[model samples]
Target chain A: MTIAAMQGIVKRYGNELALDYVDLSIHEGEIIGLLGPNGAGKTTLIHTLLGMIPFDKGSIQLFGRTEKVFSHENKQKMGLVTQELTVFEDLTAKENLEFFAGVYGLKGEERKKRVEEALAFVGLSSNAGKTPAKFSGGMKRRLNIACALTHHPKFLIMDEPTVGIDPQSRNHILETVEKLREQGTTILYTTHYMEEVQTIASRVVIVDQGQIITEGTVNELIANIQHEEKINIDVSTPGDVPVERLKGLEGVKNVHVDGSTVQIISTVGSGNLDRVLSLVKETSGVVGIQAEKPDLEDVFLTLTGKQLRDGEEE
Target chain B: MTIFTFALKRIFKDKTNLIFLTLFPVAAIFLPEPEYWPLLPYGYHYFGVLILFVGIRLTGLLVEDRQKGVVKRLAAAPVTHFQYLFQNLLAFSVIVIAQCIFMIAGGVIYDHELHEPLLLLILFIVFSFTAIALSLAWNSLYRNKETSFLVFMCVIIIMALLGGIMMPIEMLPDVLEQLAVIFPTYWLAEGMEWVVMGEDTADFLLINGVLLLYTLLFLIIGSIRRMG
Candidate 1:
């Protein structure tokens, strides 16, 4: 059964549209990556779907029932780690979990067992008594997740769970998320980090200007977009060479020379790198040359025609 | 019972809050300086009133869950809004009722006849429920808990003093007394005094009526804020 279906969702704050006729659906046991630059209606979509905020016009169905039927039982099936560090800082890690367990009406020995499992799941069993004030930034994030996970939700929604965290913690969290998905928890992960989406998400939804611009599986999205392969030449310095000289190479779709970096967009990934490297010797300052694959950023740029989204609040 | 479990857990874990919610009110009853000292068998009435009456503004602390995002998160769980508010009321009411009972015991230990235990309990409920309304009403406007808490405390402190939390209600000028009477805490304190001292049963009924009406008005207003 489909887990969630939100159709033609329209939400407004005063005159500014927070969500503009947005349509999205989540299937059972699938990880959907909500991708957008800031203010791209990602938070609005999550909040609306969770029934935290009411929309101006739209219909929401969860578990094949209307939003009203999404009762405590339905709500129990989902866990959320919000975009901010909101866990109580003064309480110990165990205390935090107990409260959440209580939130789900889990009590007595049943709650104690669940709390222990959740603490261990987040790798925080050793620090169960530690308060957020004494913990590092990563620990706080994990505690927040543990609070959400004590209920063993079927679906999880995390907003930018890895932003500003150290590489080690980020990798650990990403791995934990993968493990959750493996255990059959459908996931909706939102972030501006392309590598994060590439690593964990099966499907990518790109939102822009309060609407879903396009969405598909990661590979399908990559296949649909035609990005000019950008060949980067690390040179000692750029020269006054004719820009057309590089353009003359086979498969070279466009050429732009900026300072010590030589950027050439090639139409075909094959033979272009080789031809570019062979001609690199002609430039005296060419130090290193590399050709890279197109990523979500490229697909987004190609689809929206804007390098950065205008996510400023009205 | 649901709110009780949740609130009980919260109160048990919180150490800093012990002073603000409990010990401080008890300490207010006795003082090293006579100037700041709380009222006796007489002011115990205001004490009961202040204990629960401040609940009007203090309820802001609980409703603040939404603005702080805690309420929204908590709401998503197996709990209802009524359960949430009920738990919030439980957390403070336990403290207020305990303090009242403790004071009554103290009065008995001193061999001063405890005038009306049931009436005092009723007065304390009126006090606490009114505070609940004030808190719920203000929560919709303030997004941050600390700011809302500070504002609520300051406003309530001023109102409590003017309403006779510190002084005898009869000492005030007739005009000021009437003005202060409008504040639920004043009527609550006056009603409690009547309960504990065995006088003004008529005034007690008026205060109880005002307290019920005030609590209802706030509950209605707070429900509106919660809806938004």
Candidate 2:
């Protein structure tokens, strides 16, 4: 079942187009990673879906209701974990959860029970009384997630939930997200981290220049790219390398050189590895060579022609 | 109920705010003054100043919330914009009323006789609403907390100084006295004077009516600017 759908979302800031006729759909119990570089319309799309900002033209349907103005009931069914920590610094972890849960219309013993459960879920029960002012970066991030989950929203939207936390907390949050998926929650996770999406997202949507350039499962996206193998060669005599000679090799799709190292992208089922290795050895004194399958990072680089962390053209 | 609870909790979380809210009004009651006043008791006039103090503190709380992104969090919640404003205003009104009660009790303990205690109570309640509206209106005009606080404090101090809360407006030059009439503080204090003097019903009605008009105007402007 389709849990949420955004069709032809068009948004502009003055004369600049922030989102240009973007479309996205999420299925039940699936973690859809909304991947993009900075200013790639990822945050704009999330804000539009949450009705935090109005779009110039579009329609959003959550739970089968297609209304431009989301009713309070619709908002109650969705949870958000923004990239920035939104928890109150003056309020304790428990108070923060209680306040947000109250905003969601939870009350009495039920509200208390849910707040407790959320704290436990985020592994902050021991420090429930501590204010976010004293928490480490990772604990604050966890509390932010717990505040959103206190209401038990079926559709969770996390925008870079693990942006600047410790490795343990990042892993814990990823595991928690997986557990939420197991419990049948539909999540739309946005991040510029390809590895994060590779680990958790069932489907990946790559957005660039205010539109989705490509989207599919990790393997599907990788398979869609023409490059099947990526070969890296390091040479001892860097100045003696011939760049054009490797590009002329059979089945070599593309070649990039950086100082002493040479990267060759090649097509599948082509006996080009030995030829490329021999050519590199003859041209430049080879120190080490590696050939590996193409992954999502390569797919992103191929489609967008830049690293995920690199800024795109405005 | 949830929003009210949340607002109240937020207001009380800062112990310093509670301390100031309690101590400042009590201190205002003890300022040296003449034994015999012309229009109303010094206590009643000082009570008006207490209401403005509460207004400043409440507005400060709101400014802090906006600076901290709590307003943005609430905006994304299930609550509507109107509901958020209403709940916050309601919570502030409760605090203002409590302060008013403390002022009235202090007056009684000081053996200050009020000619129309019931009418004075009504005037304070109406004036409290006006203060809330004014604070909201002032908050909507500035985005930065420091600027908002500075502007609001300036307005409050200037209004209180010129509108006879700190000193009788009659003592000011004719031009300054005329300017005082343009402020809500002047009209609210004037209403209290009428109540204490056992003035004609028309005089009382006109003063309170102007207070309500100011409340309506401020509320309209605040809501329009905030929603925009």
Candidate 3:
């Protein structure tokens, strides 16, 4: 079932358009990754969906009912984990959960039970009495997710919840997200990390310039791109390799060399591996050669004409 | 727990706030009288500035919330923005009222004579609303907490000097005296003067009413301006 849908959404700040004719939807039990570069209207879209900011023109439907704005009751069914750490630094881990849970109208034994469950969910049960001031970046991020989880909303909106943290914590959050989906919680997760979308998102939505540029499953997006194959050739001396001759190959679309590694993007049935290897063999010693499928980064670059990290095409 | 309780708890947890809460009231009781300001006792006159600092310190938490993105998160939650602002204001007011009580109790302990204790309490409470509302409005104009706080502290000190809390308003130049009336501190000093002289009750109430008007004006301005 459709959990939430935004249609023809237009949001503007003063004269600058933040969200321009954006339409997106979330489904039940699915983790929808909202991927975009900096200032791509991802956070603006979330704010508009939650009615935290007004949209110039749009319609929103929540729980299968169209409304001009979600009511207080409707909001109670949704949870938001903001990109920045929003948990109280002065309050203890458990008090933080209890305060947010209480705001959601969870009371008495239910509130207590949910707080404990959330703490355990984030693997912070032992540090429940400790304040967030002493938590490491990863633990704080976990507590941040736990605070949002206390009320147990059916739909959760996590806006770059794992932006800056240790890999262990990032993995823990990803695992937690997967677990939440297994329990039938629908999620709309936004992030700049394409690999994160690849790791867990059931469906991916790519946004650029305040619009939904393209979206699909990871494999489907990779398949839809013009270049279907990626070749990584490691050489002892990459500088001596004939980059121009490789680019001159009939099926090769792009060539990027970094350090001793040369990456080549080519058509799916290029049949140029032998000739390409011969040319490289003439100049430099080949350490390794691997033929692989294009990933989301390639797909994002192919469609958006920009890299994910720095938004540069090459 | 309600936002009110959580806000109060956060304030209490801050050790810096404890120093301001406890030390100032005791100091207000023992401070020497201002020789220039004979209309009201020195301690009573200076207590106005102490409460102003307390009010701004409390509202600084709201500024912290805005800077930290907690306010934006609250905006996404089930609670309304008005509830967040109102509950926080209520909590700050409760702290200010407690400060008033401490000042009153200090008066009793130190034998610092008060012409009318209850009237002074009412005046302090009303002035506190104006101070808190002013701080709120001031905070909305800036996004950086440190810059906003430092600039406001300087402004408050200037206001206290010109509004008759430091010296008699009558001794100021005519032009400065006319401009002094623009500040809420001026009305606070006026109210204290009425309480000390056992003046007409209506006049004392009028000064408080003016302070309330300033409070209302500042509250409206603060509510309209969005913080970071």
Best by TM-score: 3
Q: In model 2, which runs have C-alpha deviations exceeding 4 angstroms?
A: A67-69, A233-265, A269-289, A292-298, A310-314, B36-43, B225-228
Better of 2 and 3 by lDDT: 3
Model 3: per-residue lDDT, tens digit, B1-228? 378989999999999889888887777788865554556557778888887888778888888888888888888788877898999999999989988988877786777667788888999999999999999988888777678888988988989989988878888999999999999999988888788775588898789999999999999988885536
lDDT of 2 by residue, B1-228 (tens): 777777788778878668656877777566544575635666567767667756766766666666666666666689887887788888988988887777667766766676676677778888988888887788877777578767777888899889977777888999999999899999887886787664589888888889999989988987774423
Q: Per-residue alpha-carbon lDDT of model 1 for A156-229, expressed as tens digits?
A: 89988887789888988998898899889999999888789989888899988789999998878887885557
* CA lDDT, candidate 3, residue A210: 92
All models, DockQ values? 0.46, 0.63, 0.68
Candidate 2 C-alpha lDDT tens digits along A180-281: 999888999999888889999999999988999999899889888854678889998777777788889888888888888888887776788888888778
Ten-residue region with minimum lDDT total, candidate 2 chain A: A305-314
Residue B106 CA displacement from its true place in model 2, Å: 2.2
Q: Per lDDT, what order, best first? A: 3, 2, 1
Docking class of 1: acceptable
State the lDDT at A31 in candidate 2. 98
TM-score (0 to 1) for chain A, all models? 0.83, 0.83, 0.84
Clashing pairs in 1: B52-B127, B52-B128, B55-B131, B56-B131, B59-B135, B60-B135, B65-B71
Tens-place lDDT per residue, model 1, B117-177, is 6676677667766776766776666767668777777777767767877677677888888
Docking category of candidate 3: medium
Let me know the DockQ for model 1.
Answer: 0.46
